[model samples]
Target: MTSTAEEEVLIGFGTTCYYLVFRLMITTTGYGLAALGSLIVIRTINLDNAKSWREPKSIQLLCSLIILSCFTGYIILQAAHAFIAIKAGIGGNPVSLAMLLTDDIQLFLNATIILVGDFVICWRAWVLLSEDKFWRYFLALAMIINIGINIADPVYDVPNMKSELKGVFNVLDWLSVACSSIVNLIATSLIAWKAWSHYRLSRETSIWRVGRQSHRARWVLLLIIESGALFLVLQLFALATETGSSFSGSTFDKDLTFVTVAKVAGSLWNVSAALYPLAIIILVHTNNSPIEETYYAGTQHTPVSLTLLGNMRHSASGGGESTAF
Candidate 1:
């Protein structure tokens, strides 16, 4: 790496207060969200612990435990790494394994979080888009590609991460984020299409006539928002950070700013990825599809594909209602 980059990473915490503050802020947000996620997981498990292993709720419970376990460890390690670096002062290089073992374990936790998070997203999309077999197949294929990228990127980046390690993984980091964006884009689009089709069907069927004009519009938008919209935005920020940091084979900022941006971006992606499922689980366990229950509460007609909130309890006989999730 360049002398400036080396100095930035090797400097004491006192010298890079901006980096420390930004890094701390990122971690704090992640820390708080992680804590909340942990509570949600606990509440979920406590409520549904009596559920049979054959129950579908068991699948969600299992996923929540696995994700929250990894997420808590990852955030705690990040917090510890920061403090350790601060204590180590000029000897610190938290970004590198040479500084501590945090980097090594972090890589494992990160890969697991991203891998599982992506799977959950794809699985949600697959379940939500039940009627469309073509898109389901397409989504599965995209997920397969997503799985391969998440696995291979870390394996390839690790050797390079240790040697000649820098603030960002440069090209590899951006590539991974880009792949994530593409996969999520596909998933989100499928959900939006399904939402729109169902909303139009509701309108034509006059179920939407029971309310104000914006009711139909609001319903469709809510479905889109619930289905990975925020997560997609976070992925874009992560992608921008990765590409912005060093697109031309050089750090964008010569000072501690580059490290701050990279560290914040890394933390941002980690917490956001984990929180996606946490949010869904929280919504499901607590309110159990408020949108579905609220809008379709009194109406005799419920949208065929109203699984955005995962409200598909059982497969009823219909041409449109398919619980592939």
Candidate 2:
């Protein structure tokens, strides 16, 4: 293992030591970082003397906690699979049927985690596009199919892992990823469009508005970001890794570069999954989230005009009661 020009000894296989350490590191560090994010989300929860637990902030808290719990279960399954593989490699033994069964559960959890994380991102799009019936239905139908594939993939994977039906499984996996990626693209586009429209609406409606003019640009930036576009940034990296994994699964010596890319990017994804919802929670807490009381509040349905806002005081100088909140 020295830097000298000597022959390098290889391990039993690619899936033994390399994979095990990746699992351990991913579960440990990813969970720790997600837990820290959860703490920040929890801090946003108010112990108000007047508000209910069903408040928006509390709901964010609950979402974060649930996501973390699901991620924990997934990590446990991965750690267990990695543990069994490591022991088998050390003892110069083949994995038993039961260990393969454990692998099945891990695959199931993998699908589950992806479903939950993607669903959360879809949920953001849903909220942002609340008034757009077309997008709402489109997203709903896509997610329904996404859900079907996630469920069916694991069922097929269990048998395909032992048999020659792996190609079918691969096709299903590719479809699943394609479905989710399309949804992500739509969500990102919609959010960006909404942000652009919102900015334009703000400019037109509120020249001498209530807030600082400079802040509008920042708010529009935050609007797109808080809407889950950040997840797409991480999603691209994860997809690159997934593409490499698709080329050569559980291989190191043959495609070392791709394998390393797959493993490293996947580890980043473990944190990025939880970071999706956690990012929303953080924005909601920081008041960077779009106005929670209404979706697309000023862009449609009821356009906000600052004309009244600018001259309301002048009009009210006659001392009639002002009705604005």
Candidate 3:
């Protein structure tokens, strides 16, 4: 290769890296904003009722903390990366400049935050599934492994063959995706299938099951399925990068695109998670009260008593008998 062509290749690589840095900055900022929005939505919802929210308030609060921590950590890491990239572009030593200039460490921290977030998601999924002890152990093991991998990138020194070791670090970084994706896909598929089956049975047999018309469960299932799909796409790209194909660039670009889309989808999931409990609360309160009576106390029993008598008659005549009988 000619001198000019070699320099051009280096320039191109640098430009690509810089472009990715900007993309990461923008994406993480958006995620942080979405996190703030989710926080607001959650606070607005009254999730104090047990029947509406299956998870305890304490657990939900813990998950909210993890979500916020992950958001803040990612944004901080990206901002640090941007600063380092700028310094490096000006002919500074990339490795000696600063902590953020070391992409390996920064990426490891980012991946660590994401993995913790993934485990919280898995915990929520497990709660929804009511699965056995095995799932709990499995998720715990995966979380431990992911944390170990994240620590290894910065803590384990292998300066001799940094390039090859860096690839190994990349593999570790993607392990969360691999493990969580598989688990989520299977669990979500099962949950959706179960919810759908219950809904169908409710319609056919007139049974009143907990999850028969559970929009929350259905949305959780959807979130899991979507998360799994995104993870699979990411896994395929990781494989492409590993195999040393020219198409890896395309895969890398697609991976970034997925990250962007996933951040948006994640925001939606946060809203869904928070809104699910709130919706249940509203629906239950409405069903249990007389709207007209509540609105106008003077006209209370006129509409309220009639509706109550009608419901009782239907219940007695078995017109609206629930199979829970």
Writing each residue's lDDT as its tens digit, candidate 2 over 47-81 gives 45326665445555667877787777867877777
> By TM-score, how accurate is candidate 3?
0.56
Query: Which of 1 and 3 is ahead in lDDT?
Result: 1
Model 2: residues with Cα > 4 Å off, grouped in runs: 1-9, 12-15, 46-62, 164-169, 207-224, 240-244, 247-253, 290-325
TM-score list, all predictions: 0.73, 0.74, 0.56
Clashes of 2: 0
Which regions of candidate 1 fall more than 4 Å away from where they truly are?
A: 1-17, 41-55, 90-100, 165-170, 209-221, 246-262, 284-325
Per-residue CA lDDT of model 3 for 142-169, tens digit only, reads 6666566546644543342244432233
Model 1 lDDT vs. the true structure? 0.63
| lDDT to native, each model | 0.63, 0.64, 0.46
lDDT of 1 at 172: 59
State the lDDT at 164 in candidate 2.
46
List clash counts for every candidate, in order: 0, 0, 0
Give the Cα-based TM-score of candidate 1 against the true structure.
Answer: 0.73
Note the residue pairs that clash in candidate 3: none
lDDT by residue (1-325, candidate 1, tens digit) is 5598766555544555556566667766776776777676666554333435544445666777787788778767867776666666645443544444776677778878777777766766665665679988988887788778777777776676456544544565677778878888898777666556655554454444345465646654546455778789878877876777664456474445765666677667777887776666555555443233222211223432454223223222223443322
State, as a TM-score between 0 and 1, how close model 2 is to the true structure. Answer: 0.74
